[model samples]
Target chain A: MKARAFSYFRAATIEQALDAHALVGDDARFIAGGQSLVPALSLRLQAPRLLIDITHIGELRGVRREGGFLRIGALTRHCEMLSEPLIAEFAPLLQAAAPFVAHPAIRNRGTFGGSVALADPASEFPAMTLALDAEIEIAGPSGSRRIKADDFFIDLFETALQPGELITAIYVPLFKADQRFAFDEMARRRGDYALVGCGMLATCAGDRINDIRISFFSVGNTPTRVKGAEATLIGSSLNSERIAAAQAALEGDLAPPENDEVPPAMRLHLARVLLGRLLGRLGESA
Target chain B: MSGFDENLLDEADETVRVRFVVNGRKVACEVAPRETLVDCLRNELELTGTHAGCEMGACGACLVQLDGRAVHSCLMYAVQADGARIDTIDGLSESGVIADLQAEFHRRNALQCGFCTPGMLVNANELLSQVAEPSREEIRDALSGNYCRCTGYEAIVDAIDAVAKARNEGGSAT
Candidate 1:
């Protein structure tokens, strides 16, 4: 399949990119890495009149620690998550999820911001961001604003990102000394989109889970955090009975959708199984 | 309206000049914004060693090294690769970087139909370069993106594993 003809503009600066997008209005799209956007464009699912290449924008290209958070540029490729020392040190969950994010070739070209901005329900980074309690930085015609990962995702294939808004970077809270993290997903094949995936970040006081965030993807319209499951383990020790209770509490948290390939019942069952397995790992590590 | 509707699709032939290095040689060409690198390589330059299968980026048939990074050529627009260095299957094979792996593939019969060979070699090169001695599982993980309908991947894995072992042996054996 071939994409419809579109005008192209390479942006050297974020301001140039924003200005170009504003000039084209809804007829333009910002392309970085292009792993997702190119596929959509080829399938003719999206045909913007102008494609503003943001890969060359120097300002949106590196990772740095600012204050209490590690700021990851929107243009950060998925493969970078595997090797970037900052990501490995600050956001290990994203690093763990990197290998599971598509094949090596796609990972080389897919950007972290592109995945989060696209907000595909099945993607790993968005859910990992939610687990890490990251904030998404956005720049648009109305200046810039930061939205928490929890509030960024609105629905399936939809986000709080307004039209013409560019995700400049993702600011993830630095991993703490006491934080214990684990990430896992069950897919039919190695690089296939996961049937069910989950990530957990818990701050522990001895064996007790002081504060925990458990997030699941490929289970709902948006990457979801199981607050009910988190509640069951918040004050409790990592024990069999507590883990079972949290697994049982998953019913109140996620309602995975049914499709021709996978029924809702099966998806929910997989989600529960995945949750148990991830929690089991956390419990062992604890 | 559909995205490919004739009336909606622009046929203005708008093109931009892009200069990129392919196979260690600098090349400049005029390409449309919609032209994928695979298409540019196959159609414009007649460098047909890079095949175009599942242009949607699922198949690794169009794998190429862009700035030493293995990427699906079909997923990238030519304009996006402007000023980047590319190493295609032909280039890598010609340079002898993967000569031993190629010999192993031939010895192991990694290809039944041979359609996925070029891309497989490109991916294997990247894997060997990154991982000093990749295990069978690691080779499988690295080549997960590449689809080989024929061969069932066992021979392909055998070839890569053999190459890794041979290389790890301090080049004592071929």
Candidate 2:
């Protein structure tokens, strides 16, 4: 299926993109890499009257370090997450999850910010953001403001972004020496959406866990932070007993919706299995 | 706003003029805002090698090189590709850039129906350019998007593996 006919506007600057989107309001959408939006358009799931081509905007490009955080521009492609040295050194979790985002062709065109903005519950980067405790930078008609990743994702395919606002960049706190990251997803195929995916960043002190953030996707409406499980591992060693406790805690943290293919019980079982595997890996790294 | 801004298409405009380099040739044409690059390349530009399989990003059948990177041409509007350089399977084959891989594929009988050959070739070329010697697993991983109903993909992987070995050993694939 082809997309509905819509006016295309190539914005040279961030201001132009916001202005163009403002002109049409809800009828317009800012297109970054068009990986997801284009598919939605073709499927007629979304048909905006105007497509603000934000790819040409210079302000939304590049990845750089600022103080203690790595500022990754919204236009950073998924492929860059794997190849960019700054991201590899500063935010290795994203690099670990990049290959599972999609295939090479899709990764070549998909943007990190676009994926987060789309807030697909089955996506990797959005969940990783929660684990990394990243900040989402937004440019709106009034002014620019940053939103924490936890507050940015509201629901499935819904974000905190208001009408006519554009995501400018994502800021992740730099990875430190004490941090250990692990990411894995179970999927029927290599590039297909995960049956249940997880990414975690653990801060350890010697053999004990200091702090950890565990985020799971495809388990709920939004990328969920399993506080119950995190609490189970805090100040404890990632041994089999602790890992089992964390896995059991997932029963309260996650409530997989009933679906035709995978029942809720089966999904929760997979999440437990995945959590145990990730925690085991994190323990080895520590 | 500058006078150049006046050239921008309005919301009411049904067609927009776009120009891009295809296979090293500068080509300009008028296209509807909804017209995808795959459609434009096949219909207007007459580059039939770039097939439109799913018309969505799922099928790699419509893969093309936009600015030297493999992407789904069906996923992008032609207007968005204005001023960008595009390389289609027709262009890549004519240029002999992936001739060795093509020869190896032919030798292995990698393709039967051949609907997925162009995309596989384009994607394989991309993988080989990036990784000189990719493991069979890597090759399979790279070709995950390029689905083939026939040949069971074993031959396709074998063909790519052979090409990578020949190229790495500093020998001709033929």
Candidate 3:
């Protein structure tokens, strides 16, 4: 299916993009990398009147260290996560999740901000953002503001971003020397969206998990953060008994809806299995 | 007599001008904002070597290198590619980077129906360029996005493996 005809505007700056979108009102959609948006347009799932091409906007591209956080430009492509030195040194969780996202070709064009802003329940980056305690920066006509990832994603394909507001960058606290991270997912195929995926970051002191943040995707509306399960593992060394307790705590954290492909019961089972495996790996790595 | 559907009329009248380099040659054309790079390539420039199996990004038949990065042409707008350099199967075939892999594919019968060969070759070319002697698992991972309904992929892996070994051994890619 062909997309509905639309006017195109290549924005040279953030202000230009905001002005274009504001002029077009709600009928305008920002196109960066165009990995997910282009497919939606081709399928006619969305028919915006104006496509604000923001890929050329210099302000929206790069990975750098700012103060205590790694400020990754919204337009940073998925492939850049693999090569960017700052990301490797600071936010290694993103680097770990990069290969599991789609494939090399799709990764070459898909953007970090686009993935997080889209907030697909099954996508890896959004959930990883939660695990990493990243903050999303938004620029609007009035002014710019930063919000925690926890409050940013509200629902399926929904975000706190107001109309005419563009995500400018994602700020992640630089990884500490004692921090340990792990990410894994179970997919029918390598490149297919995961059936159940999990990412975790823990501050380890000796053998005990001092603090940990656990996030799961493909099991709920938003990237489900298992705070209850995380609480179970905090301050305790990862052992078989503690892993079992954390796995049991998932029942309270996630309420994944039933789907045709995988029943809700089976999804819960897979989530438990995944949590166990991830915790096992985290124990070894720590 | 068919009625004049307003939406159809609107789509028919809308077109945008785009210019980009394809296979080292600069080309310009007028296309709709919705026109994908694969459509612009096949219909406008007459470069049909890049096939479009799934208009969605899944099938990978519409794979092309944009500014040296491999991407799905079907999932990109022609205008979005403006001022960019693109490389397609036609360019790669003539560039001699995958001549050895092509010959090995022929020798191993890696292709059956031949619909997925161009995309497979493009993906394999990328893999061999990066890792001169990639293991079988790495080749599978690289080609995972591309779907081949024919030849079970064993022969394809063998073909890519042979090329990787030959290239690593200081032999030219035919």
Give the best candidate by lDDT. Answer: 2
Model 1: lDDT equals 0.90
- Candidate 1 docks with a DockQ of 0.44
Alpha carbon lDDT at A24, candidate 1: 71
Tens-place lDDT per residue, model 3, A1-286, is: 8888887777888888887777778888999988889889888899988788889888998898899999999999998998899999999999999999999899999999999989999999999999999999999999999999999989888899999999999999999999999999999999999999999999999889999999999998999899999999998988999999999999999898979999988999999999999999998985
Worst 10 residues of 1 chain B by lDDT: B1-10
| Candidate 2: stretches off by over 4 Å | B1-13
Question: Candidate 3, residues B32-130: lDDT per residue as tens digits?
Answer: 877889999999999898999988889888898899877899998888998999999999899886788889999999999888888898888777767
- Between candidates 1 and 3, the one scoring higher on DockQ is 1
Error of 3 at B110 (Å): 1.2
lDDT of 1 at A51: 85
Ranked by DockQ, top first: 2, 1, 3
Segments in model 1 whose C-alpha atoms lie over 4 Å from true places: B1-12
Residue-wise C-alpha lDDT for candidate 2, range A155-181, written one tens digit per residue: 778899998888999999999999999
Residues B1-174 of candidate 2 have per-residue lDDT tens digits of 221142343643578899999999999999998899999999999999999998878879999999999999998999999999999999999999899999988999999899999999999999999999999999999999988989899999999999999999999777
lDDT (tens digit, per residue) of candidate 1 on B28-141: 998988999999998888899999999988889999999998999999999999999999988988898889988999888899888899899999998988998888899999
lDDT of 3 at B56: 88
Please give the lDDT score at residue B88 for candidate 3. 93
lDDT of 2: 0.92
Error of 1 at A2 (Å): 0.5
